[model samples]
Target chain A: MTNQLSLQQRIQMAFPGLAAAYSVDGLLHYRVEKSRIPELTQFLHEKARGRLALLFAVDCRPLAEKYEIQYLFAFASDHPWVLLTIELAGQDRLFTSITPSVHAAQWYEREIRDLYGLIPQGHPDLRRLVRHEHWPKGTHPLQKAFPWNKTIGRQQADYRFRHIEGEGVFEVPVGPIHAGIIEPGHFRFSVAGEPIMQLEVRHFWKHRGIEKLFEQQTLSTAIALAERVSGDTTIGHSLAYCQAAETLLHIDVPRRARYLRSLFLELERLHNHLGDVGAICNDTAYALAHAHCSRMKELLLQLNDRLTGSRFLRGAMAIGGVTKDVSAIELSEIVALLDGIEKDFAELESIIFANASLTDRLETTGVLTERTGWDHGVVGVVGRASGIDQDVRRDRPFAAYDEVPVNISLYRYGDVRARLRVRMDEIHESIRLIREIRANIPQGPVAPAAAHRPQPGQWALSAVEGWRGEILYFVMTGEQGSIHRCKVRDPSFVNWPAIQWAVVGNILPDFPLINKSFNLSYAGNDL
Target chain B: MFRILKKSLKTGIVTGQHPHADQPAESPSQAVCEKAMPFRQSLTIREVDTGSCNACEMEMNALANPIYDIERFGVHIAASPRHADALVVTGPVTVNMERALKDVHKQTPDPKLVIALGDCAINCGVFKGSYAVTGPVDRHIPVDVRIPGCPPRPAEILKALEEIRRPASWK
Candidate 1:
């Protein structure tokens, strides 16, 4: 609380007459002049030392005659989020770009330009970020006037991919459709001999207009959409969305439900991390580790199905609390399952580390230095692997994280091996967390009987540290308590840009290994 | 190496029996069964993701894992569409991927089948009315079979493929 107060004082000292209101929701809203974005965000990012977590635009027209741009900076300390708001009149379509000063604002600026048609005046690369070539010009889907179901005619426009031209430099284009059973995105690699010189990823091939679709949904129905934001992080996204809804609706979740939410979040993490550990080994042609890991992952998914009705743990999270409660018998069953997997995982971990050949492929392969990680604002396991040493569960505790303190595993190597180690460590930690939650879990009603309607114009920002990274949701309630604008920042949005830097000097075949190490979500990023 | 060998030996064979080993084949699937008759013996599948949340892809990948190992039943995921006997597609066809979906469908040769792998692919489940959606897989291509579920379980998917692979037994 003192840290938050001092931070507010510092911000007030920096900007005279700014009147930065620090609300109970942990948001310090500074509604500033449009011209002050670059300086304000740079000051907060560098001086205040906050990670630029999310930047998005809300089309507040018809309700209000302006487009509100929100730049949310999350702190490594107990300090609250500094939300820098720049409202532009409906007629004014431009705001000064903060990308030149604060590098993390690059994609957010371009995305705002694409979705809301609010151009960032001085952005360096203003080429299309979200929209494809065929999307008709002047069709900003997020605007209030644009109906969600309206169809626009397609147009032809060529995309200009970054070119590296020289002798022995060859360009290889791969996938809007990959050979593997994964989501689609195009990768253009500029390679010479074996090592890649520059790699550009063209994505958003799976944009289902999810953000606009949120506007048409009530708060209850929106949880289903949130669960699908990234299927792998089903609990993570829905939990964040539900927390935001709970905050807006002023519904307090019961103690047992909060504990269950934490437990399930760890379960989701365990399965994904275990799968990646096996996948990274599989990329190196080590089939033994892959086979065991796949079996372990299958067992975990089956357990999830037995406990919750969904293998991926969808429909597990509700608005005020979790949908289902675990009985003593089910909890014992989970304990038994974890006990068996714990021994199996230990043996598997030994085998993986024991093999020098497997370790060689992982070490020094696809290194994303700590500096690069910070520059790109990478979050989650990828960021921790690169020595960021930040976890939202510890930094800003949510659910039952406050009661059961989180132990974060960090590495500085920032290589494929570093990423693998981080994941392995996290699996161990998740197992520990589940055991802790089961032992200390309080007995109570899972959810409240009814949730009161949120007032229009009320908004809340919720962040959950998903298995992949940090999943942030900025939700606002509109008239009739409908979702006004729900901006989802899947960790992939920030982390995807950093992959280009990671694969620079690496060989082409090692690309899959490095890519799998990160395992970013295309559906999440595209949405 | 000794540890791996020991572990492998101790674990022993884990491959399970086929979905229809104990009982007779259930009723033949819908109209798609006639179309599925050709690939009854062995089937090569090419999985395409139009715009799914990736749950379908997760289950599809699970089919290849040691537990399911659909390969024992002569079902394989081909590296290229050209080698595929059927295209197992997932997701509601997004506008961005509409052209690519058609191009992939066109590339598959004659007597090829298209299976819409999840609820989203069959009818754009939750994303039906969104402007960015072009529609389901059937809107773009003629779907031979539809596997229903937010993402169908690997066992359920195996049973469907088994029915497709052995349509005559069910008939």
Candidate 2:
């Protein structure tokens, strides 16, 4: 990670044609032309910099005028993020492509195309990534003028993937409707019954226009919007959004608030990771582990309810301070619960690990080579399992994480087992953090933030290493009242490609297990 | 087999009962429709994407998780304008979602309660004016309940729901 790219440096390096660094709070954003996105993405990917940050598009005709789409990129080696821009003309415009350089860009590019109709030419697979097949193609729902009654104008031509047509090469089209209640993603599996030759994913059942709605809106409102980017990653997304807002406003949360925020974020990871570990066991048909993990997760939820007053710890965070304060009785109760859950989780995980059948199923199942993982720039448990040693909390800390250290777990064998191990170990670490934060809970106003923050044109970013990985937020003020632009990048966006690589040789039954191994949020991606 | 027997004896009854001793949400058939809030009821909410990027919906569903157990409240998301109640909306209600919001509101069962939860819903929190969203839930829907916070906690959601249920006299 030597000679890392700072915000300005990264943007300069990635998009050399782009010039000038515009300071927004502490983060630097380079406002570059839209035409050079593909080249920039290629350059960044070549260096194995990091995952594609996020694609943000907004229609500002109502406010200050331009209808623009901004693309943000981050480097794991350093905290620098490049913000590239494209202003769509005539209220409707299209842009170039970047899928060729990064295969992971296939879905993201399609998503951008579907929402904004900014066609990413040269994208190998330009199929719908979020909207269902029935959705109108040219509508681009996220665009400003697209009417709500926007129906499918023309029946989207049947997606014609390069079908393998030989005696042995057969097609396996799995559902837009899957067996599990997993999000709607159509997988076109090219296989010899079980062995997958090539896999193509047609996504977009959950396309909800989030960016189009944020124009001329306040930063506070967007945080909740950000929270819903992914259900499991609420704390992470909120932390990122708040960090961006606070950075843009040049405000900081109290130490107590910061500690409390981290506590909830880590607790979120604890609960989710526990469910993942248990779910993997359930995948192996190990009944006890499922029941035990479910119970442990349940207990943790109860603790969240008692401490944060919300099972998922949503609304617990605020831009300046926390919404709810940790009470003494609640903290002690949570400590006890965490202790019990930790003990049980540890014992249950050991028992599951001890069982050779469970290990056999998980050991080599859904393996993602480190090279492929790095190439896609995967994050969280998915990347950790694959031995891609990059974590935002340790690399760049925000909120209470700055004070509390994280011991990131890693194993060279990037499989379900490694993911499970990361989940288990992270839980242990979270437990310790919960106890520590609770013990040192400071006394202060959990609510001290001002009514409204700085005037328009200020920009800032706050990065929090949410349960998934790093949740980064970029905020720009406009109208001296509302947000000009906001970008949300979930860990799932980074890990979705890695999951595709993992699914290559896996049995279709194991697809769910492998998919869960990298549980990317459909809502986050769709938005 | 003997060790299994010993362990079973050591750890009794891991399985139990209820809403019926098992899991409620797991099986759609088993869920008893206790006090159904059918779409025909007073408030008809039309969900508009209003370009939020989609974090609020994820949590909105989390309310129904077996743990938080929001189904017991008889609150559920509406599919289309035909069957709707106060649109419990999320995100910044992005511009892309604004038109959809308006049409949906137009389509709802009327006397709709617009409970705006999450920061994005209220004032476009993070994405204030991204040249995307036109404004908050109020700019589009006649918002009644404004639940603030970046993305209000699920408890906040429950609180907003309860608040919407209250009559103006109670306020």
Best by lDDT: 1
Report each candidate's C-alpha RMSD, comma-separated, in the order given.
1.9, 8.7
In model 1, the runs with Cα more than 4 Å from the true position are: B17-31, B167-170
Over A1-527, each residue of candidate 2 has an lDDT whose tens digit, in order, gives 22443545655665566765564433345555667667766776676465666665666655545666666666654555556667766644567767667765666677677666776667777666555454454566655566533334335346666577777878888754343324445678788777776777655444455555555358776666666667667788877888777766657578888888878888898888887777778777886676666656766765676666556676777878778877778778778878877766666656776688878888888899899887776777788888888787777777776677777788889988888888888999999988888877778877675755577666665567777776666677777658766656667666765676788887777777777767777666555
Q: Write the per-residue lDDT of candidate 1 for residues B48-121, one digit (tens) a residue.
A: 99999998999998887788888888888888888889999999999999998999888887689898988899
Per-residue C-alpha lDDT of model 1 across residues A1-527, encoded as one tens digit per residue: 88888889898899878886556646788888888778888888899888899999998866799999988898865788888888898599999998988899899999999888999998999999888978899988898889999986899899999999999999999999998888999999999999999999999999999999899999888999998888888999999999998988889999999999999999999999989999999999998899899888988998998889788998999988988999988988998899889888999899999999999999999999999999999998999999998898998889999999989999999999999999999999999999999999999999987658878888988989999988899899998989999999899999999999999999999999999999999999999
The 10-residue segment of model 1 chain A with minimum total lDDT is A20-29
| Alpha carbon lDDT at B82, candidate 1 | 86
- How well does each candidate reproduce the native contacts, as fnat? 0.76, 0.12
For each candidate, what is the lDDT?
0.89, 0.65
True contacts kept of 1: 0.76
Model 2 lDDT, residue A411, Cα: 83
- Give the per-residue Cα lDDT of candidate 1 at A493: 98
For model 2, the stretches where C-alpha displacement exceeds 4 angstroms are A1-19, A23-26, A33-41, A47-51, A58-71, A76-79, A85-96, A147-156, A451-453, B1-171
Per-model DockQ against the true two-chain complex: 0.72, 0.10
